[model samples]
Target: MDTMRDRLAPVLTRLLDGDPRVAVLLAEIGADGFTEAGRRHPDRVINVGIREQLLVGAAAGLALTGLRPVVHTFASFLVERPFEQVKLDLGHQGVGAVLVSAAASYDWPAGGYTHMAPGDVALLGTLDGWTVHVPGHPDEAETLLRHAVAAGDDKVYVRLSLLSNGDALPVDGARFRTVREGRAGVVVAVGPTLDDVLTATQGLDVTVLYATTVRPFDAAAVRRAAGAGRADVVLVEPYLAGTSTAAVNDALTGVPHRVLGLGVGRRELRRYGTAAEHTAAHGLDPRSLRERIGGFLGAAARH
Candidate 1:
């Protein structure tokens, strides 16, 4: 399959060629020189220093002028700094703009807190009229990006992590997949964590669900997966606990749901390491997740 960057480059290039009114706002260092080498129409690339707020504001302005703007930046700065701009400027006006965030979670190593952002899943999910997508693999990313651009929603946040060379999951459009459909238990995995979930529950007799769209989660499908019997559901996310996991649990009501959150706890994370190392340290690694799932299953079997 093609790399995430390769898949996106062509689609973005085609968008530029087809739409003269479409503009792309990318960070100075984050563009990775794709704009220069790629086929971008003349003057369509807008570089807004390192100011995250300015990036969103400029995109909002561009949207007001009937030009579709795609804002690209690190997840940390894109969501935190320009949150108000996203909420008021783009969200309030219902201006169609796509926020492309990279290095979601601790994808980058040694970049420290300034670069690592695991809370975007939760933060972006809170906005009204804003769709949140966390693609697990390159193929899914490509398909989702194309769909997001074509859908032309007012506000949309697409979370992307470093493309892992591992096998890509089969994703068709916006539909989520059920790895194992059983009435015993449900394990909902977002993004690449689907791999981890499969690995962790090797011999377990439980169902695994892969969800790409966190916001406006498929309630009907989830209810169907839960079945009418008493089932135990668990959510696995590469973000802090309070956001995605809590929200999913609350949505599942009556059903016994548990959240397996990765990254820092309630306190701030002060240590610096690679995404894998950080995740391992915080009990988000495959081994940790396996143990957690085993425990959940063991307890469930008791009663």
Candidate 2:
């Protein structure tokens, strides 16, 4: 099974060929993947060396010239290291660009903490008018990538990951799709966490929602999924814990709702272990999630 990162080059290549306005900017990361595209459209496909700041600034500059720039790099360098450029270059200028990131969370554990960006989504949440998409499967990633590029000068962020679900859910990259329906609670799974969430919530009486596009956070869908009684929501994100807690709370305004935000913890583990080890340490594995989700919902039911 190909990872989301594996799909980036082919999809972007197709987009670049089809759309004249589409441009790709890289920071020496994943430059080899675009060799053919760069040869075909040298002006559109640019590699600005190892400078992460230039990657974003150049994308914004291209957007300024009426071209839709799709920027690529690791999550940490693309979003965290050059965050100021993301904010001012694109946000402040009111220009649009597609910032597609690779290596979600602890995808490259051996690369150290600098490569791991568990807070990328949360950090981007601080900015306004940005659409965030965390696709669970490569198919979903391709769908969201095309959606972002064709969005007509809208600021978009497409998060790619080495982690993927067993199967792809039919997602249009706009709204949340209902995977399962129940009455006890609602489990909103983001990106690669969907498979784990499904495993954890199996046989539990709860509505499971698959969200690829998180930013315009489907508040109405969440409200409807919560049913007419007490809302017990467990947001299982692949990023920082409680990243979407505020959005869930606001969705249930004036209503009784209990939200349990389960994700990558703030404590950084210094050991260079495998990504699976990191997932277990963060308490985001299927076993840990099952225990936590059950306890949270069971406790709410008792009250």
Candidate 3:
């Protein structure tokens, strides 16, 4: 159980240690910390200036020359600015590289709208042959990153949250954890909101599902958890209530499924706040989730 920092540093070291041709691209700001790590394996690290579009485009070009490239940048710039490059140069051209997105979702409080790109999932989902992964903790992050490196996918986007000090939840990229399996109701959570989901289920006969992968969801696992009889399923997220929840609900057609999509609303968000604040303001806090789950269960019981 290595700390996330420990896990990530060594994984980067190994990637650098193994391939001299492989380049590690970092944002100007991220360079400070990553550069120190790169000192242990200096030749592999390259700073791509503040140009995220060029960074991704360059990575795609380098991949064409038989060199594996790992690009790192804020999620916002990576997804928005170089969207054309991502879809055309990387995805359409069938380039093999990993786009390591830092500060995913509400993790970047200091980074306002320009810096915050919570919709990376929605953006990447549209690209063909692009593998999208959002790791809940550092351990899983390391594993998934390594897999992306070796994997032969044309394009891969990994949305990484800040390092969590808490214990890592049991995740295997396929079977999500069902913390509690009760006949009463079902609560499904996606990435890092497990705490809120758990809190929302107190004193209720609820089955909780931790959905780690928003794309390529496990339909069988979801259907089993949703239960065929009379259980109610609620999908929870920390982003806009669209793709992930909608996809799951669509998959479980004819089943009783409800989505509680929680994220930054369409309205212009003004204040800069931490992930906790954003979740709370968006009705994703534990108390709010608890109330909603209780009401849903109560209604289900009556029917």
**Per-model TM values vs. the true structure:** 0.89, 0.98, 0.87
lDDT by residue (181-211, candidate 3, tens digit) is: 7777677777766777787777677778776
Candidate 3, lDDT over the whole model: 0.70
lDDT of 1 by residue, 16-111 (tens): 778777678876745754565334465777888888888999999988988878778788888987889988889887787988888777777577
Model 3 TM-score?
0.87
Among all windows of ten consecutive residues in candidate 3, which has the lowest summed lDDT?
Answer: 1-10
Q: Which stretches of candidate 3 lie over 4 Å from their true place?
A: 1-7, 19-21, 36-43, 163-165, 254-256, 299-303
* TM-score (C-alpha, index-matched) for candidate 1: 0.89
**How many clashing pairs per prediction, in order?**
0, 0, 0
- Candidate 2: how large is its RMSD? 1.5
Task: Score candidate 2 by lDDT.
Answer: 0.93
Better of 2 and 3 by lDDT: 2
Candidate 2 versus the native: TM-score?
Answer: 0.98
Judged by TM-score relative to the true structure, which candidate is superior, 1 or 3? 1
